[model samples]
Target chain A: MSELSHRLSISIPFENDKQASMARKTMAVDPVLKSNELLIKFNQEENKLICQFMGTSDRVIRVAISNVIDNVKTIIECFDEFDGKDDVQFEEKQETI
Target chain B: MTQDLVPTAHYESPSEPKGYDFIPGDGPHSTIGETTKISDIVINAGGQDRDTPSEAKDTALGQLRARLTTIQDKINIFLTNKMKEEKSSKELKDLEKKMLDEGVDEGSSDNE
Candidate 1:
């Protein structure tokens, strides 16, 4: 069995208590999910992604989380490309049988 | 009576007063006036470190091109490696599925 590989992780903040609860719920199931108040950026020179979040207000935390997720997705997309070779693609025939 | 306009010649003359004599100061050293050196000094300083302008520019351009080529090579290597990893993972997954289908796991009588 091929192991799933994760290349990066990040976090952001949420200020809305209600939204923060919802976000926590989502993150509970997804290990890759995280949030921070400040938008994290991928620094090519540093060769790492960075994000910083501060403050306890729930509403702001939710916004931070959204921003963090968007930024992470953008960074991943920058490195990702369309290739027709993957575990799922290879196992398709076996699964049919 | 028609006024005759004489054509003026455009000539540049020295702006400073002509034939101005610069007399040395008649101080206490005037008796032993400063002597001017008539001989030229042959400077044996080191050679110029830099190339001619054209040569320098060519060298800079060549270096820039080399750096660009290196970056391109790195990008190509990264893309090739990514493709290889994808292919390798795919093949491994297929092999795993095949083993499961062939009852390779069931024949293990370790429990029996």
Candidate 2:
């Protein structure tokens, strides 16, 4: 419960609301570690993904922020590699079995 | 000849330069030793005048804003490419499916 010394907030804009929502959902699934030393919150506002971090030190804040950014990168990679149509086709194929 | 080869008893010691020898408007006259400051590598998120706790927080906020903007730019580019690829591939798959269905119908009609 020491006073959080550092705070960082970031808003990443997406092309549309859907992509922002996807990013928010993906990030929400992963819980932040060291909740006492750091806090991470993510929200989707229109076409922007808003991220906030509060930590006791610069290192903790930076580490939390970077970890989220890494996850965002992975989400972007998945979107690039696969589309909703492919997922639908996959599901349909599985249903036939 | 032997005296000329002999070391002098009053050998002059190398003297240190009084100050940096560089012309005011010209390039460096000699190489300056490499030096690094913490401020050079570590961002003083709170500027040099971080006297109070609030001031330090403000500096950290400023740094966060700057970093976020950079991250935003990167994510924007990646998302754009992702969307473009998704659209193109979906179109291609739709076209292939349509062609396959048409060929199946033609084969059935010819068998009649």
Candidate 3:
């Protein structure tokens, strides 16, 4: 294709570079289900995780971008739940899932 | 509020890709299981690509509404296709069964 039919960029600011990098790496590990119709690239800018989405259609990019946002929300939610909870019993036990 | 946990996004695009540095994948086909041939959510993109929001139709809300409409239209088309496929498949099966029954009846007459 001469030009991508749809494109979007999202920036999420984390607490630090480590957090941003973590988010980027985690999202990077997951594969894009539709590579032809959609491609996502994750980068880090200081404390911000920058995500770029290029796709062939509005719906394809929309679905993919929303999914990434949902996953990032979960990662941040985990930070809220246990990031600073030192000496928490949850960390001591092995994670099953 | 506990913190500013909002994510910002934009639609600005750069020059066309050079067909290089394209990350390789499992080819240019969908890797998702249970995929549908009905693709490309047909949508008339509004003033979402405008550099500045000049009117009500160019605002952030307007862009969101446009995007949502794309999804809505896609959902409608997908459901319609599903219904059409189901109806055609059912009719084909019924026709096959009818032909089989007619063949059996004709065979009985020849047996005499």
Candidate 4:
């Protein structure tokens, strides 16, 4: 009935500014599918990554937040597993079409 | 938007809890929108830094990992179980339609 007022904001911190920016860029790439029903924004503050969500109803907001957290975990895992190592080159070169 | 942005100086220290209003998903399927109808939950943590303070990287990592995992597990179970109600609703509609069609058939047979 009312406008989108249900809001949730999540802030995540990283070791440095670069990691925070990386998370923001990666997470912000995907736009909210139902903009009228829900809205999401990604921001980086120094070593922290921030996510804000507003939705028409609680249901929409919860689902959207869960999905975002899942993505965040994956990024955290990446940082945990391979934070500073150089990117590996495959033994054989593959041509890109 | 620039409207709600707060300066870094005003942000709280990492050691302190940002104290965001946590709304655990309501009902079995994380499917309740009732509570937030009138009031909003707002948590202002130094521009949203849930990360543990820098003194303990191990503690910070564990805290962050624990939080993400908890949210993931809880939501996954809720979203999975919430479909039961939806499925039952569809089945109920189908059963209603069948009963209506059968009633029409019974009436025709009575005429015959």
Put down candidate 1 lDDT per residue, A1-97, tens digits, no spaces: 2211211123222222333344344434432323432222222112222233332232332344334443333322222222223535444454654
Output the lDDT of residue B85, model 3: 67
Docking class of 1: incorrect
lDDT by residue for model 2 (A9-67), tens: 66665546887898899899888788888878888888778777666654565456655
Q: Worst lDDT window (10 residues) for model 3 chain B?
A: B28-37
Q: Give the best candidate by DockQ.
A: 3
What C-alpha lDDT, on a 0 to 100 scale, does residue A65 get in candidate 3?
A: 66
The predicted structure with the larger TM-score, 1 or 2, is 2
Can you rank all candidates by DockQ, best first?
Answer: 3, 4, 2, 1
DockQ computed for model 2 against the true two-chain complex using alpha carbons = 0.01
Whichever of 2 and 3 has more lDDT, that candidate is: 3
Pitting candidate 2 against candidate 4, the one with the higher lDDT is 4
TM-score of each: 0.23, 0.43, 0.47, 0.51
Candidate 4, residues A1-97, lDDT tens digits: the string is: 4577556676677767898899899998997898988888888879888888767655676688777876776676677667877898778777999
Each model's fraction of native contacts: 0.00, 0.00, 0.35, 0.10
As a whole number from 0 to 100, the lDDT of residue B93 in candidate 3 is: 96
* Alpha-carbon shift of residue A24 in model 1 (angstroms): 44
Model 2 scores a C-alpha lDDT of 0.49
Which lDDT tens digits does candidate 3 get at residues A1-97?
4356556676677766887898899999999886877889999999889889887755576577656754675576555455656864545667888
Instruction: Give the per-residue Cα lDDT of candidate 4 at B11.
Output: 14
lDDT measured at residue A57 in model 1 versus the true structure, 0 to 100: 30
Chain A TM-scores, per candidate, are 0.33, 0.81, 0.85, 0.87
